[model samples]
Target: MVYQGNDPKSNDNYRAVFGASSAPFVTLLEELPDEKRNLRYSLFCDNLFTSFHLLAHFKQLGYEVTDTMRENRIPKNCPIAMKKKNRGSRIFIRP
Candidate 1:
């Protein structure tokens, strides 16, 4: 769908509808169905919209979201382990 910022009547400016100072996506989520308001739904979004704040918001709503984050965006405390040999190498990351 096209977001016609040129059309003032069109609520295409998310920042305007959601508010610039809002905790990011609060306004965006408000448009969701009332039944799904506080339920656990898996949200799959693009990397541009992924952030800890967004995830926390989803959690607050009892929902979950998934997206590929930049290396720097990942929590540094997560664990990672690796074992040798090209023939048999075991690399594991425990969340």
Candidate 2:
């Protein structure tokens, strides 16, 4: 499930995950009878999270995830780009 929260000091946008645990998702899932726990779900999260434990838990439960990263943890061969339309109408591919 997706819900919005805020940083206490700056009031920045924050998203919370509640799955297989928590009051709301638990309540919702509990209402559904005979539901299989093997079902897979996808989640997108920011790199602000330091631990991979939660994501590993999801993987153990057969779920898939696509995470956005703020850290330079990926390999060098990975393509990283920032689009700037104001620069030009040309397309340049760099290695």
Candidate 3:
């Protein structure tokens, strides 16, 4: 596992590679050994690492991804019901 320092200088390589958006998560996945990286894998992550862009990126790479996402991270155009309106319910969105 990689340790990320709070200071900006310590994360320069991560920033350079991923630019922005869930770099820590992306870094871990990308750093997998070649055999693991080439095989299809299911990735499960928490809200802190979940975003529409990250989901799409892994989906395109043939990995099955599942995660809990913050309400704010939901795309504005998505039709999922608001959390308050559908407590304990499951909502699925397909692209």
Candidate 4:
């Protein structure tokens, strides 16, 4: 979905439906038809739309999510190694 920018009412509506912490990308997923939403599908998104909480939310709903996340988005206590340390190594960290 395209965000027109600065729509307080739309943001409020999304928050009401998806909760206060919901990102706009969550709204895109939530806007899917009920039938589509019920299907357990794998979704791919970019860092701009990815977050640990978002992944957890989708996982709870039986959907698979794969996306790149910003380093700062990683939980401080997560066990994943830093980029330089993990370079050239295969490290898979699941949310």
TM-score leader: 3
Report the CA-based lDDT of candidate 3 relative to the real structure: 0.72
Write the residue-wise lDDT of candidate 3 on 1-95 in tens digits.
65364434335665555345577676677778989888988887788778877888888878888788888888789877665665767656555
TM-score per candidate: 0.49, 0.36, 0.70, 0.68
Output the lDDT of residue 48, model 1. 60
By lDDT, rank the candidates, best first. 3, 4, 1, 2
Per-residue alpha-carbon lDDT of model 4 for 31-67, expressed as tens digits?
Answer: 7899987998888778776677777878888888767
The ten-residue window of minimal lDDT in model 1 covers 1-10
Ranking by TM-score: 3, 4, 1, 2
Clash list (residue pairs), candidate 3:
none
Where does candidate 3 stray beyond 4 Å? 1-21, 84-86, 93-95
Candidate 4: residue 72 Cα off by (Å): 0.6
State how far residue 61 of model 3 sits from its true place (Å).
1.0
The C-alpha lDDT values of all candidates are: 0.51, 0.42, 0.72, 0.70
Give candidate 4 misplaced runs (Cα > 4 Å).
Answer: 1-22, 82-95
Root-mean-square deviation of every model: 7.4, 10.6, 3.7, 4.0
TM-score of 1: 0.49
TM-score of 2: 0.36
